[model samples]
Target: RLPVRVDVPVEELTRDDGLFLVGTPRGVLRARNVVLASGSLNCPKRPPASADLPATLRQLDSSAYRNAAELEQGAVLVVGSGQSGGQIAADLALAGRPVFLATSRAGRLVRHYRGSDIFNWMTLSGYLDVPRREIVLPSGKLPPRGLLGATHTISLQSLSAQGVVLLGRFMGIENDSLIFGDNLDEHMRFADESSADVKRFIDDYIRRARLNAPPAEDDPAEMIAPRLPSPPIHSIELATSGIRSVIWCTAFRGDFPY
Candidate 1:
């Protein structure tokens, strides 16, 4: 696929009496046999755990990442790439903001070499039925999870090629300046280089877990990425400290959606 864009309003999920996993306007997307293969919640968000960092980092920015014009440039940081992060990064680049995008999980490879859309590998591989933790279990070796679904990993190379800096997950934020885990770059580069390896890792991990294989022979990724420096953080002193606006693109957790 060559990245053809689509225009469908999700609101079409609300026209029926059926139970809604999500209540979109179209109608309830009902399932007689509901299974949560990836029991993740909505996007994870930041919390007010420090002093000096603006309280702003802890809440949802009404405009999302695309309208980052209100943010100051030079050191802008974007936290996730699920659709929102990608759009935000694209908007920042178009707006010419010195942007930085970061995420812990490298995304899936689009099916076509040109990135039209991800390989329907998740649905294709039947992972939708596997327990979610198969990807995280120490003794398990599933696909690297780079193939689950469409991720925002919104163009790591594109960001760099276009001059947008990228980072790893947000450990915390420093006074106006953000503090990230130390291995941000290394972790990211590894994800970027071998998405294929990540996929293999995830595949094996799940199989092992399903078969109750012992830890002695779990097949981790053949390509071992240099582990990120245990802790990654971005620290900038508040006021004129380069990063004027911090866009937290981290994910949201799954709630009952009541």
Candidate 2:
């Protein structure tokens, strides 16, 4: 019945019993209850998901490739180096497949690194007066559970040690291969594990804080260090399986085209 309108982009799926949607630059469109299987904002340089395509195409979005080959015969490229990208790339590489990870920024470490997790560190130290604390995280593609990131930091460290190759910057795709703007491969070859020293020091801090529990001295910001660098995403290459899948992982504006 609604053949021609099937191709249009729906701006908003209203909350009413009748699903009301505003079309892109057109007008309002409606359905019973709209389901938003539609992916992120559109870009001209990427491909939509297609089965039998290269996993690299699914892995790296538009930032890496204009289009990817779907035969799965060539190299797989994992874009980005934040916890997700790094983890993905490491998994691919360890599988004995040729893979590459593109990163626009370098990953960082906390100033005071400890073998213990941050939550434990916080409790053992004087950062939090209560046993539990609250944290806020940026809202994104992930489903909303609460306000903050609660994952343990160990996952990132383990991935870095697993041998994921890190590349710097996207220079655009060329010559059937993904390339970088700079030579970061030689430097980021391994994770910074010596950070254990930082962690051990935190253990010492907590021990001292426990002895003074109430207030021997107020905690100073200078005493606690910050996190080390980790890479942020620019773009990705999803064209490894033969079909290029382009995804834009950048921040979005409040886009409404009604």
Candidate 3:
């Protein structure tokens, strides 16, 4: 086997005399070519607003959260409406713990559609094979992957149905309250439309290719969001609220400083 190094983190990379010099805690390695294989989701990105939270509350990144039982007794606030945030909030609610979920603009995905898994349709419809250059949106960023549960569909509305108090985008901390934006309805609508857009794209592809796919069917899980009696909470007092811990599922970034 080729020489291998385990548990040795690369500290820096430089070029000298047309060769790459890699610095690590073990030693320096000189090579003709180097591939920085660190993954995009390797570094957890904590929200800057978290700094305003009082030090009494425990803060944990999405990666460090194992289960609801490990948390202190009281309500839990989950930030970000992406896959990690949504699922963790659901898990906490199901465990009989009060949950407050701060929503984001992440899209939702229906796991199964038109008598087939969404992943299968994406593969057959060539949606997954699109070049990265062609898929970047007007905002100069790639469209994010839609949020879905491990075995089914999940959405902010669904979480709300499960007794999880839905809140708008987490802004920052005020005097004694956690400030939130008043765009919860907008975010929920965006997630619904995004899922519909994907299903429509798949439908058009099937028709153009003359494939004998089954007729589109409504997914109960996707349609499970019930109408709310009032708008979601815009701000919450952390002290008055029974919240004791917060799980930050605000996503991650792959940053290379060296």
Candidate 4:
């Protein structure tokens, strides 16, 4: 049986004589071929603007947020629109707390489509298992995962319908006000296009494979689009906004030391 190490903090990793030398608190271990299974998401990433946020307002990383009952008695400002940000904002709003979401260009996905889970369609379409070498992006980087609810579809439009105020890309704090970019419409459009692209990919796969999948059903949640602010909100004075807490659901970073 192969040996496994648990609760061992790797202090350093080195290569010598075609062998990997791992230094841990206990001792050094040698192996012919080492597989680094240490994950990349070891630290929460907050925007540089986070440093300029007002001192009185409470700020918590997305990783630290548990529930609305723990927050102060005021509105919440979720400063991202990825999976965590969207879900947290939805959770707070559903719990009867006012929530303001600073949106990003992150895409959305429907949990279930065409009488099957979206993952099933993805596996059948051969898109889920595409090799890394086959991925081609303009910047030669991998694409980020889109926002998909755990058991239901979550979209910007649906969040707006639930009384959560949506704002544009957060620029920074200016003169005690939260400055935002004037691209809320563009952000929303991008989410719609992303969902449409995925649906189109699955549709093409079904047609090419001659699979007799049931017809697509209209998701009423996605159809609800609240009228966006004209010219988009460029700034909101923090003092008057009633926002007492800010959740930095921005992203995570790899904390690899080698």
Candidate 5:
């Protein structure tokens, strides 16, 4: 049987010969090998604009954010377009709050294409098993993850249609005004192109494999279409715009105590 320790904080780890000594709150422990699973989402990131916010305003990283009910009275500025930011912005806007979503160019995928889930299509296409060595970028960086939902795809486009103000990537805050980049059109185009590419891949895979997939339907078009245009906002005066809170969901990093 393997022994396990829980609720102990690891303070230090040192290697001697081929073994590792771990210092913990309880005591020192010895191990032949150590596997660090610190987790990717342990530390949430905040934007630079968050640093100079007034004391009166509330700020919550996406990890600390629960729901619109948890926020104080006033509008909210969600400073990312990733899954967390997209979902949270939709949630707040649906709850009748004036929500502004600062978007980055993130890929979008359909929840269900034809009669299959997008994940199933991904698996069938062998996209999930792509080797890192074969596809590694020159910069050694992976591509940004696409926004997907298990139940149903949460479309930023749909969120825009639902009264959520979509802005370009946040630049920084200048005095009382928040500045944003002028790449909103480019971001929207990228999302649309990425989604089309995915759909095309799926269609080709079905044809090549001779899979008996359902015929094309209009639902896909209706679902992917943006009902409203993304707002062309360069900057907004935070105080005058009635925004009282900011939620930064830029990225997550692993936090290793030792």
Candidate 6:
């Protein structure tokens, strides 16, 4: 059995002669082997233009955000369309607050497709177990961020249906207006392509494994249905837009002072 220390805050760590010296509030402790499990989401990132906002506007990052009830009384502008930003914007809109979502090129996946959860197919296909070294992409390119939630598909398209005003990637602050790009069409197309790629992979796996999965039923209405696209907003005047609060959900970084 191993001894566990409770409520002991680690102050410093150093190495000496193949041993680890840990300094804490009580005293210094030594160990032959050490493990560091500090997480990455502790440090939240904000847009570079966040500092230029007026003092009257309230700002909160994803780390400090709790719920829509705590936000100021007015329209809420959520920057970044990642998991946190999407969910928070949906929640706020559902709670009767006008939510404006500034979107980026984060691709999305359906929660369930072909009578199975997408994650189940990912596990069966060994996609989740790939080693980091085997992962490859073009130079200076990164993978798209996936949507967050369980057993339900939520995309910007769905959020737009629920009265969330979707804006393109936030550029910067210009005068009293927030500048945004006009890449809404490209972002939507990227999401659709990503979803199609995943579906194709699943279909190929089913065929190769000779699984007797039934063909997906066709929904004519759904296939022909057209969704109301989110109009691109080039810029938003903060003073005139009635936006009282801003939520920054860009990304997170690791901050280890030690």
Q: Which candidate number has the best TM-score?
A: 3
Alpha carbon lDDT at 19, candidate 1: 47
Predicted structure 1: lDDT: 0.50
Model 4 TM-score relative to the real fold: 0.87
Q: Between the candidate structures 3 and 4, which one is better when assessed by TM-score?
A: 3
lDDT of each: 0.50, 0.41, 0.86, 0.87, 0.80, 0.77
Q: Over 4 Å off in model 5, which ranges? A: 6-9, 16-18, 131-140, 218-231
Question: How would you encode candidate 6's per-residue C-alpha lDDT over 66-146 as one tens digit per residue?
Answer: 888898899999987767787888789879998888888776777776777878887886666877556445653345356
The sequence of per-residue lDDT tens digits that candidate 4 reaches over residues 1-258 is: 878878988899998899999999989999898777768787898989999998889999989999999999999999888889889988999999999899987888888999999988988898678887676457765554577788899888888888898999899999999998877888888888988988999999999989999999877658886756565678989989999999998877788867
- lDDT by residue for model 2 (126-195), tens: 5446332243225324321111113323223344344544456555654444445554543243223223
Q: Judged by lDDT relative to the true structure, which candidate is superior, 1 or 2?
A: 1
Which candidate's lDDT is highest?
4
For each candidate in turn, the TM-score is 0.52, 0.39, 0.88, 0.87, 0.86, 0.86
Candidate 5, residues 40-114, lDDT tens digits: the string is 668886766678877777988988988899999889999887677878887898799999888887877777888
Instruction: Please list the Cα RMSD from the true structure of every candidate, rounded to 1 decimal place.
Output: 10.6, 12.5, 2.4, 2.7, 2.8, 3.1
Residue 201, candidate 3: how far off, in angstroms?
Answer: 0.6
Root-mean-square deviation of Cα positions for candidate 1 versus the true structure, in angstroms: 10.6
Which of candidates 4 and 6 reaches a greater TM-score?
Answer: 4
Clashes of each: 53, 41, 0, 0, 0, 0
